[model samples]
Target: MSALLEADALHLRFGAVRALDDVAVSIWPGEVVAIVGESGSGKSTLLRVLSGQVAPDAGGVRYAGAEVHALGEAQRRRLMCTDWGYVHQNARDGLRMGVSAGGNIGERLMAAGTRHYGAIRDAAAEWMVKVELDPARMDDRPGMFSGGMQQRLQIARCLVTQPKLVFMDEPTGGLDVSVQARLLDLLRRLVGELGLAAFFLTHDIAAARLLAHRILVMRHGRVVEEGLADRVLDDPRHPYTQLLVSSVLAA
Candidate 1:
């Protein structure tokens, strides 16, 4: 099968800083790929470029047979709303604080032309339960929920539309250890159940190991290592990757 998303020779810069250099990426349907690196390593920048949130200076990206950069503003927005899901590190950024939790998930359905109120509400409630949230809390505002709950709600909102590809940036960031573990477990199960193709951006090797089938290690805006998750982590070839794994071991 052709790649669900494919990019070749990506290069991006932010003035004097090089955010991406000769980067390439590919994800097939139902495949989970993780990008891992330290802060300022361009992990998040690579994700932004692939998801069409940021334009690469010299590169081409194709998603579902369409050239991403060539898409019009309205076309891009429509694709983002209906076919793609992005989970921000901060739930507040991805969520609508002004609306109820159910409303947030239902909004995606509405964008997809689902008009019946009952159907929207029912789908929202079911997703809430799937993400381990209480269905009874559907009417609560995101701000009223705890940080972990809000993150789970954000996930439900993203996944309710059943998008084939999801871009998740540190979904478990800033949560308590127990909460993070619980959230990771929930995410793992949901990804399997939904057969999602996902890009998981994380600094935590363990988290990547738990969710990703393949791993890419980045440093200085370039991918230094790429392979099956187990092979890369177990016998890392690149010096940077070896150091990364050793540092995690030392910790």
Candidate 2:
């Protein structure tokens, strides 16, 4: 498959810290690529650059064969609204606490030019069911929900627009283990059913293994190893990657 998103020779720096260095990666349609490493390893930085949230000091990002950075701010925003979704590590960051769950999902539909209230409401309810949330709770505010519920609602909101690609940052990071497992299962199912491509960042090897088809291990702003998820996690080649895999196994 051709690449839906590509980052070439990416480099970024914050003062003396190099957040990304010559990072090159690609994501194809219906694929999930995970960037995994310890904190400060530049995994998040890479995600930001790839998603066009941050411009690299030296490099380029392309989406669907167009230079992403070359687009005007309004164009970029419109592209993000229509073709891409971003799920932040914190549900609060992705969700509007004051808005009803259905309202949150419907807002994206409206942004995408849906004007009929009934259709928007129906779509939001349908997405709620898909994410395992009760459609009856669609009127409740996100602040009234649990952390896991908020995250699920966030996912529903993002997917309701049928975005071709989604960017997620440590999606399960703050949840309880059992909740995380359920969310992961739901996410896997949604990704498969929708045929959506995803670029996810995580420090958890198990999360990467469960959700990612391909894994890129980063350290010191550089990718130390990358391969199929099973290969990279089971028999990591780089010492850093080996240590990451072993630590997860030992836990």
Candidate 3:
């Protein structure tokens, strides 16, 4: 299987702090790779770099076999025009609060250079349905919805473009326990059904086990351990991985 996304020898730094230190990972088509790390472990930074939000200090990022770092700003923007969606750790970061739900999703189509109003609206409605949201809520602003619903809307908006790859940062954060579980279930189903490849970042080991086929465990800005979820979580080789697993089991 070809890698849908690849990062090789990636390194990034902010002032004196190194965020990503020679880290590497890859995702193939139709695979879900969970990035598990404590805060400041560079998981979010990796996603930003992959999405072209943060340029790496050194290393290579190749998407669909194209050299991402080599592209001009306009060329990269055009390449990513509608081929990617990002759900930030905070739903608000991924949404425009003033816009109606339908408008939020429609905005992506617009950015992709789509101009037909009817087509954009229809696409937004279809995405809302896929995320299990009611079409009637299309006119509602995200401020009117529950936290869980807002998160779902963000997901719907990003996945609407039928992007081959989606990046999610701590997606279930800030929701109540039950709401988190429900959203996770919905996300798992949507990814499976749509055959979308996801790079899901989470600090929660249990969530990683639940949602990922492969797990990459990070500590101090490096992938300390990586393997199939069952192997890494069930038989952790790194101390940090063991600690993470133990904490989840204890909780």
Candidate 4:
């Protein structure tokens, strides 16, 4: 499969601390790729660089053959709204707390050029059901919902646009284990059913194992190992990766 997104020779720095160095990666259409590492290992920084949220000091990112940094601000914003989705570690970062749940979902549809009120609401409601949220709660504000519910609402808002690619950062980070498991299951199903290409960043090896087809292991701002998820996680060659896998298994 051709790469839907690609990053080459990425380098970034923050006050003498290297956030990323000589990194290269790609995400194919309908593929789920995870970046796993300990905190401050540059996993999140690489996600930002690839998704156009942050500009790298050096290197380039291309999405569907278009140079991301070369696009105008308006074009980049439009691409994000239309063809790409980003799910932040915190639901609040991706959701509009003041808007009604349905309104939030409808906003994306509207941005995608769906102006009909009835059609917007219908699509929002359908997405709510698909994400396992009750349509009856469509009028409620995100603050009225639980953490898990808010995350689900956020996912619904993003997927309602039917974006070709989605970027997720520590998607289940703050949830309880049970909640995380359920959310992961839901996410796995939705990504498969929609054939969405995803770039997932998480420190949780279990989450990576559950949801990623391929895994990239990072340490100190460099990719230490990468391969099919099961193979890399089960038989990691790098010391950092072996430690990561062992720690998860021992937990």
Candidate number achieving the greatest lDDT relative to the actual structure: 1
User: What lDDT tens digits, residue by residue, belong to model 4 across residues 84-158?
Assistant: 999988999999999999999999999988999999999999999998999999999999999998999999999
Per-residue C-alpha lDDT of model 3 across residues 1-251, encoded as one tens digit per residue: 79998998999999898899999989999899999988898888988888788899999899987888887899777666577778887899999999999999999888888899999999999888888789899999999988889999999888877888889999999899899998899988988998988999998777887889999998877899999989998999999999888887555
Judged by whole-model lDDT over C-alpha atoms, candidate 1 comes out at: 0.94
Task: Give the candidate order by descending lDDT.
Answer: 1, 4, 2, 3
After superposing candidate 3 on the true structure, give the runs of residues whose Cα lies further than 4 Å from its correct spot: none
Angstrom error of the Cα, residue 32, model 3: value is 0.6
lDDT of each: 0.94, 0.92, 0.89, 0.93
lDDT (Cα, tens digit) per residue for candidate 2, span 148-247: 9999999998988899999999999989999999999999989998999998899878888889999999999999999899999878889998888777
Give the range where candidate 1 is weakest over 10 consecutive residues by summed lDDT.
242-251
Candidate 2 segments whose C-alpha is farther than 4 A from its true place: none
Clashes of each: 0, 0, 0, 0
Q: Ten-residue segment with the worst summed lDDT in candidate 2?
A: 242-251
lDDT of 1 by residue, 92-124 (tens): 999999999999999998987799999999999
